[model samples]
Target: MAGLLAAMTVSLTGTRVSAIALPWFVLTTTGSPAQTGVVAFAEMAPYVLVKALAGPLVDRVGPRRISWVGDVVSATAAGTVVLLHALDLLPLGALVTLVAVVGAARGPGDLAKEIMIPEAAERGRVPLERATGLMGVTERLAQTAGPAAGGAMVALLGPLAGLAISVTCFALGSMIVAWALPRGMGHSAPAQEAPEAGQKGQEAGQEGYWRRFGQGFTFLRGEPLLLSVVVMVGITNLLDAAFSQVLVFVWARESGHDAAVVGLNSSVAGATAVGGSLVAAAVAHRMRRRPVFFVAFLLAGPTRFLVLAVDAPVWAMVTVFAVGGFAAGFLNPILGAISYERVPRHLLGRVNALRDSLAWAGIPLGGLVGGAAVVAAGLTPVLLAGGAAYALTTSLTGLRPEWRQLDRPRRTGPSVVPAPRERAGTTDGGRAERSP
Candidate 1:
């Protein structure tokens, strides 16, 4: 678990450093905000596209292998960028292409790591929720560290130095994955079993990649509770992107606060969020999933926009955002645990890839949509509408019948493993079988 988590944090830190450095590099080089946006888009589009398409490949080839290759690709690309810049050979087109490659490789690498978490938790004999909380902490720490390191490196040494740091991080991540983890830890069992391997070969011969992808869709479609969670979370993610990208900046600027105010508010919120994840890790097993999920969403989702709608004082806004980020911290651990518990071990890679891609689809367009809406309808109206939508998405969606499944207690005692008969009815490969 430590090995995997370390690898993830390092890789994620590299990615986040790139997020900061790449924009600054582009802006300084071209002196065009338009080119910066284009570079950003170039990276993210390939990321989403590759992730959505890589599920079956991950399932077939194994996540450990994919993760290793992904890191290598990213490291090579980042290193090449550094070399090209030093040689004065990196044109805008080449830079964009390299960034796109890094993004494309990172997407599956991330998904592959995600697919390994449940098994890692089981091996560690820790509860899934706690394990996920730890995973969240790793991510939060990376998010906090990456930008600060990136900015300092860029300012003191230059953007090439930042890219060089990114390359080092990626290489270190790859080394950890290659040397630290046990052999075949993240690979599927069927790949090693002769009979299962034969069966897989037969299936592959019969069904194409699209068919395998469609199988994930079919599984998710039959599970209404999961569907509800995905759609609701997807909408919230869209709202969050908008808030982070456009609304908050506008509010800070219009309210006569400097960028430092925004940074301070975000730093407080992020710190509290880390604390919340640690708390969740400690007490999650004792808590009921449904109420915790609902309350977290209620506090975290709509409240920020609502607070901004009234144009509250900086202190009030900071307090609201801190509380909201803290509440939000609990959300992912619960969701991640539920997802792992419900999905079958064999299908984890494909299903998680597809589900995550769908949920994340709205992120790229969010800033564009928010800016357009602010232009057409103005900021206050947008905030109010976003707040209302978030409330409706969470509150109204929670009333649906399928959400009751979330209330099922964590299976305890010696009979943690389900019998074959008990597992027959499950659609999504989970231990608990669901009746259609």
Candidate 2:
């Protein structure tokens, strides 16, 4: 667990830093908001596409192996960008290509690491809620530290230096996973064949990749609760992408604070999130899932955009984001616990991949849409519209029937009744009696 957390921290921190550096670099270099959106789209489009497809492979090959390979690939891709830029050989086309490669590698890598958490938590004998809360802590802390570091580096040494540091982090993360953990840690036994259905020719052969994919989709189809969660998460993620990738960037430029203010705001939000996750980890199980989740979304979503929509001081912006971030921290632990409890362990990889991919499918489009929207409608209007949309979506979704599942206890069935001894023909003395 330590090794996994450490590796995740390092890898995610670097990624977050790069997330800041990449856009700032684009905004500064190209000076076209549309191109900033284009680069963001180029990277994440492949991320969603590859992640949707990599689940079967992650399950078959084992997550640990895949995780290490993904980190190595990310490191290589990041390093290539650094080297090419240093050598003056990187054009916009080449840069986009490399970023896309990094994104593709990260999709499987991040998913593989996520798949390891349940196993890790089980081995540690920690409650799934607490374990996932701790996971949230790690992520929040990384988000806290990464942007601050990235901003500092970009401010001092330029964007290339931040990219260089990102490569180093990825390399170190790969090494930690490769060398620090025991072998076969996250590997699973071969997947069992699915039961034959009545359909002609479908049951005659080993299941193909598409068949396995179908199995996951079929499983989700039966789960209305999970489906509702997925849709809600997808819409929120889209709004979040718009805010983070485009709206925030444009606002920073307009506000004339740029990287420093962006980093400061992001860091504060992340730092507060760490505290929130800690509180959640300690008390989440004792709390009701529904109201807590709904209220958190209400507090976290839309408020940031709405605050940023008007002219406000930097402190006001920070305060709003901090409130949002703190509320946001409690969310994933609940969601993760629910997901881990509901899904079969063997299908974790495929099901998680499918769910996450569908949820994240809107992200690439977010940057594209935000950029185009800004070009068409301008920044403040876009921010206003986004906030209103977030509020409406979250509010409307709370009224859903399926959303009630979040409030239910983890065990859905009635308590088991004790069998009568006479019915079993057994004595209370624990001896079997002869039947007449």
Candidate 3:
């Protein structure tokens, strides 16, 4: 558990740092928002697609191995970018391709880590909400530290230096996962019963790639609550991608600030977010999830964009982001708990991958749409529209009947169909566990 959390923190920090460096690099080099959006698309498109497909493989191959391989690939790709840039051989096309590779590798790598969380919590004898909240804290810490480091590095050393840091962090993450985690910690899912003698070959063939993939999709389709969450989150993720990948950078440039200011804003939010996460971790299990989820969304979304839209002072902007970040902190712990409770253990990898992929499907298009919208409409108008849309989406979605399930009692076993010969009362070690 210690090793997993540590690796997650290091790897995620690097990712957040690169998030800043890569976009700044593209924006500065091309001086085109459209080009910047294209670069973002190149990375996220492969990320979403590969993550969606890699679910069955992760379950079959074991998350430990996949995580190690994925981090190594990410490190190599990021290093190549730094090397090419240093040699003055890095073209826009090449940069896009390299980032795409990073994104593709990151997909399964991140999902593997996510799959390990419930097990880690069980091992540590922690409650589900607290464990997930701790994971949220780890992420918030990365968000806080990564942006501050990346901003300073970009301002003082340039974007390539930040990319170099990303390479180092990825390498370190791979090493931690390889050598530090306990034995049998992330092994493949338990095997099902043997096929009947007469139908052995046919059954074996049916258990191949597509069948495994379809099982996850079918399970997800049956869960109205999960599906509703996915759809709403998908829209918000698209808006967030646009806000982070394009609008924020553009705002910084227009306001005559450097990457340092961007870092400061994010870091402040992240720092405050850590406190929120900690509080959530300690008490979220005792509270009703529905109200907390909606309230958090209300405070976290819309306000940030609306503040920027009004051309508020830097102090005001900082305040809004800080408050919003604090509210945002409660979100993941609740969501993670619900997901882990609802999905069967055997389907963790595939089902989680599909859920995440569906929610993030809009991310690839976010930058594209935001850039084009800004080009056609202008920043202020786009910001206003984004805020309004965020408010409406989050608010209207809460009224649906499916959302009442947010506070459902924890299940003793999988909510969906169990595997052949699996017992009804048995769970991960006969104890109910959650994830983040």
Candidate 4:
């Protein structure tokens, strides 16, 4: 499990690099943050929408196959972008279309990876907390390594060329998944050779594609904790969406600097996040979850706003991002573990989809909202709003009864009276009893 995750981490580093490079490239090339934001929205919108739709597909096709397909698609898409750029015909519309495809593919890939953790571990080789911790660590490592690598790659080869490396990494990761997996009719469907009656009967037992798809919605509606968490998270995410894309380039423009300077800021955030991921891996299980969630949320908002509020030195902004990234690092694993532990495995896809969809639900609005925010009060006010929203949402949610207590083991069934033993099954000594 660790090996798979570690290998996959390399692929994610490619993704991380692209995240930095793509926005910087878009903003610089167009000289418009709004356009940069449009690229972000196009990518993220499909990601959010398709991820929700694709979750059940992961469960159905089984994680390994879905993962491979997603990776391959993403790799191909990335390579296409590179090709377009090399040809010098990479229009903004074309870029948006390509990124949207990548986002769509990534939805399945990410979902499959998340589902595989519990499945790969099976009964007891890996515990949820520990596995999730390691996942956090993997992500952190990517965060730390990705930006600098991306920056260096872009510097040496240019942004379009960087995609070639990313494509290679993703393809390699997919190959790793393709070859290594346990097989035997995964995804809980009837064998293809089943009799007609058996097939009909099975169809009744399991939902068709459309029916199964709708169940994702039903599942979310049935669960209160899931709904609450997603809603609050969605709120904060909306606030974040407003500034996440244009941060570095906007900052550089505001400070009268260059694109390279923007990369430096992104690299700092990635570095700090890596440290936080390691810490999360080490201490996640020992820590009570509620407090951790609350405190992290509380810290994230203010740190984000503060970074934008003051016209401090570059290092000062970097410091703020470091703090914010640290807080951000702890969130996903904690929430993922929560979902894993509490939600039933069969419904994991829909649940994940619902949560992810909600979290990303605010993304489309980012371009419009971010543009407005930048125009009205400058980056500082926008950052401040994001921060305040982050803190306020977390604090309020912490007061909920369900989230107040840390997660623990759950009872599986109602208690029943114990049946009397049959004369102790057999007497062994002076207190011997007759057998039936």
Candidates 2 and 4: which is better by lDDT?
A: 2
lDDT values, one for every candidate: 0.77, 0.76, 0.80, 0.65
Best by TM-score: 1
- Model 2 vs. true fold: TM: 0.84
What does candidate 3's lDDT look like per residue over 268-336, in tens digits?
777888988899999999999899988988888799899888878889989998998888888888878
**lDDT tens digits by residue: candidate 4, 144-176:** 677777878888877766667778878887877
| Candidate 3 lDDT for residue 243 | 90
Q: How many residue pairs clash (N, CA or C atoms closer than 3 angstroms) in each of the candidate models, in the order given?
A: 0, 0, 0, 1
How many angstroms is residue 311 displaced in model 1 relative to the true structure, after the best TM-score fit? Answer: 2.0
Candidate with more favorable, higher TM-score: 1 or 4: 1
Ranking by lDDT: 3, 1, 2, 4
Candidate 1 vs 2: which has more TM-score: 1
Q: What lDDT is obtained when candidate 2 is compared to the true structure? A: 0.76
Tens digit of per-residue lDDT, candidate 1, span 219-274: 66666766777787777778888988899899888778888888777777777777
Candidate 2: segments with Cα more than 4 A from true spot: 23-37, 189-206, 249-263, 309-314, 371-382, 409-436
Model 1, residue 424: what's the lDDT?
19
Roughly what TM-score does model 4 have, to 2 decimal places? 0.81
Pairs that clash in candidate 1: none
Off by over 4 Å in 3: 24-38, 84-94, 192-206, 246-263, 374-381, 412-436
